[model samples]
Target chain A: MLHELQSGFMAAVLTGSQTELTSVTPKIREGKLNTAQRVAIYRRNVQSTLRGALGDIFPTTRWMLGDDKFLNVGDQFILHAPSTSGDLNQFGRSFPEFLSAMQPSAAADMAALDWAWHEAFHAAEQAALDLSRLGAVPAEQHAALVFQLHPSARLIGSAYPLLELWQAHQNSEEAPLEISKILPADHHFLAVHRDDANVTLTPLSAPQFHFLKICAEHQPLGEAAEAAFALDANFALQAFLIQTVQQNIVIDFNEPS
Target chain B: MSPHHQSSRPPHALDPLCAGIGLRPPHYQALLGKPAAVGFLEIHSENFFGAGGPPRRYLDKFREDYAISAHGVGLSLGSADRLNPAHLENLKKLIDWLQPSLVSDHLCWVGVNGRYLNDLLPIPYTEESLKHVASHIRQTQDYLSRQMLVENVSSYLEFADSTIPEWDFLREVAQQTGCGILLDVNNIYVNSINHGFDAMQYLDAMQGADIGEIHLAGFQDTGEILIDTHGAAVSDAVWALYASAINRFGAIPTLIEWDTDIPTLDVLLAEAEKANVMLEQASFAMPTREGRRHAT
Candidate 1:
């Protein structure tokens, strides 16, 4: 009976429908506030809490869409895809996909980048690889070594200039550029990672992005370099490797067994 | 229950009479630059569920000076469905890491049927619900191998099928599970107003309860009902109630919890100082229990 009441209360809160309240309303005491009013308060709290979680993660998207539009979209998404986890941090993983389906716009791309930045901010902290260790490996064995990206590193390729969009929204005083006015790139690659206390977004060229992507997939250094070379004849593997290692993106490496 | 593994680290002790504040992100830098004058810092355990990040880094930094309280908001201990193992695992990880002076969550459910509403939803005060919550609390204490404080939540409505008083229900759950009570004085005041019960009566009933910690927070008055928003300053009435709680419970570790529209470190510390004043004025001294354990 308690389970039945909880199910009914949940339905009443989620659906906000009178029909769903038949089982719940009778079970609620009639005080200064009627059962409907009392249930409505809970419904509001649930919606606002979920919306606040989304808003916190995707502030750039919220700024792009403005408060009213964002709230409307957030309300719909709350009903469409209710949170499965008790942790609010894990609530909006599918929000960008939902937005992509709802409207194929740059805002959806921005939401994806926001999600990436959020993940990077909260991902496990791993130590950057010591270049000396790489130097110690025999030059011949280096080809077989599989490099790994930092646990917090995420590679995102988008059609929109997400890094610039996110940066533009950082300063609340500055007016946001119109999405139509901003030029969309054919392919924009980015490396999102947490450096110490801040989350940083570094733009990447196609070859560089692919190289890191390959490494992230656990490919050997030689294979990743070859893939990068295939994209561009002069991919500059050594220079890029040094840059990534310095940036603390490539955190560790494993030798071939 | 024996700890799954004993922590070699020494326990961080908190003064039972001193007040503390909730550690929010905005005041991290400020708190770190110059540690606030408080006994401990309370953090919502779920916020640091991530493997590692700035939160964990800052918490570690704060831990050096202050005792930490791993207060959880997502355990859903009162839900009819079975407790979530993943949530329990994450909570255990945080507790093991922080080894907080106190760990607590609401005496209410946040979700059921695997879908989290993410709000402190009230539960009916029935024999069935009491047994369910008590069992979950027991399981949680066993899993974590430590005592946990369960706090009362403010509710706008009451259940028609409830067969027990709220105070009796909370007391019975603690008695059944051997869990300590984290009495939120503000909630008692809010619930008293909304449900037309005497606030002093609720405190009177909890006189002998294992009051491990006290929560002092602000609430929003919607004219018709009081909402535990925890945004504004703690009201004079709630302060009065907190003083009464301190007098009754004998200087329990108090925390000034501000979750939304969080103010600067100074403002929170000021509120904590207010609670500290009350704590200092207490004439009685209840024998403080160190890590209230669950009965095996």
Candidate 2:
């Protein structure tokens, strides 16, 4: 009996249809509000709540889709991408991917960037290893030095210049954003991370992205720099190292661990 | 390591006799420099479950000043599906760090079958559900190594086969499982208005010994039904019900929860001040069932 009520009720909620509610209908009391209206409240709550969550977590997506379109997209995302976790923050991890397939508005690209920001906002805090400490290491060890990305840092690659697109949309003083008109036609690489709880999205050169990606993969510095050099002959290993260390991108490096 | 991880025990005990207000972000910056005169602070468990960042930092600092209660909207304590071990683990990790005075979630299920509905969906008031929910509570309490108070959810619909009343099911869950209650007065009032039950009777029905906390919030009337939006000030009827609840249960830790359209901390503290006044002005402020338990 419990199984019937639960499955039936859940079906009604997910489908927004009353077909399966017959068995559960008798249990509802005859009150000022009828059974369907009562069930409709739950259905609406589920939609509105999840939609509200997606909007909060992925505001850039909402902005791209506009209010109604985002909600419409949100509903479809709901039907296809069921929230698997109890945390509302954890609800929309798949939304960006879902949007990527659902619409052509490039909302998915923005969603992905937005999601990265959200994750970086919550990622663990780790103090980047001191550059002077690395410099203190013997020059011979420089090749073996493997830099670790800050725990809060994430690298994202996009066909669209998501960081610029995101910036333009964020500019309240700028004219109302039209993605096609303003977004530069270029592939973009960026890193998202939190410094003192301020989540930032900083653009990265292809060489920088490769270097960091390889290092983040736990490769030795020799190999990581080689990967960067492959991407750009003028990878500027010395200067990049200084910039990354100051940015706290490379934290607590050690021998192969 | 996270600053919270540095602590082995909570800074202090949550005084279960004062008023608290929900802590949201808009008021976070102001509270940092000049916190309101709130008796304690309450927060949704998931809000702080982030790996580590500013939210954690603020909460770590806030814990030093006031007792904290980890009120959870997730955990889906009554889901038919096995309780999410990951959810429990995250909460356990948080408890280890925050060491809140009390830990609680709704006496409702939010998800099932690997699909998280994310809203507190009503559970049927039946023996089968009672057993399921009780077993889940036992598992949670055992795993958490602490008591968990479950609050009732305001519902829009009722089950026809429900032989037991909501008040009875809630009381039975506490009685059988040895758990505590976080009686939400606004939920009671909202349910009373929607389901045609006497709010006073609902309060009178709860065993005083079982109630560990009291929740006060506002509701929205969409002309047809009252929704527990938690976006407004406590309605007059809810205040009246709370007064009745105070009479039956005596002074307990009451929280003024405003989730959406959150006002200034001044506004939140004002609502909490009202609850504090009720706590002080209670004619039945004498120790009831719970007070005796504490005494002996």
Model 1: how far residue B178 lies from native, Å? 1.1
Candidate 1, residue B30: how far the Cα is off, in Å: 2.4
lDDT of candidates 1 onward, in order: 0.85, 0.83
Best by lDDT: 1
- Model 1 docking category: medium
- Tell me model 2's lDDT, rounded to 2 decimals: 0.83
Tens digit per residue, CA lDDT, model 1, B1-296:
11222245665777766788998999888888776468889998999988777777787788878888989999998898899999999888877877788899999988888888999999999999998999999999999998999999999899998999999898888888999999998999999999999998888778444888888899999988898999999999999888777666677788999988988888888888887767766633433433322112
Fnat for every candidate: 0.70, 0.65
lDDT of 2 by residue, A92-182 (tens): 8888878767653456788888898888877777766666787688888789877788888888877777776678678853433665554
After superposing candidate 1 on the true structure, give the runs of residues whose Cα lies further than 4 Å from its correct spot: A172-175, A180-184, B1-8, B207-209, B284-296
List TM-score per model, in order. Answer: 0.94, 0.94
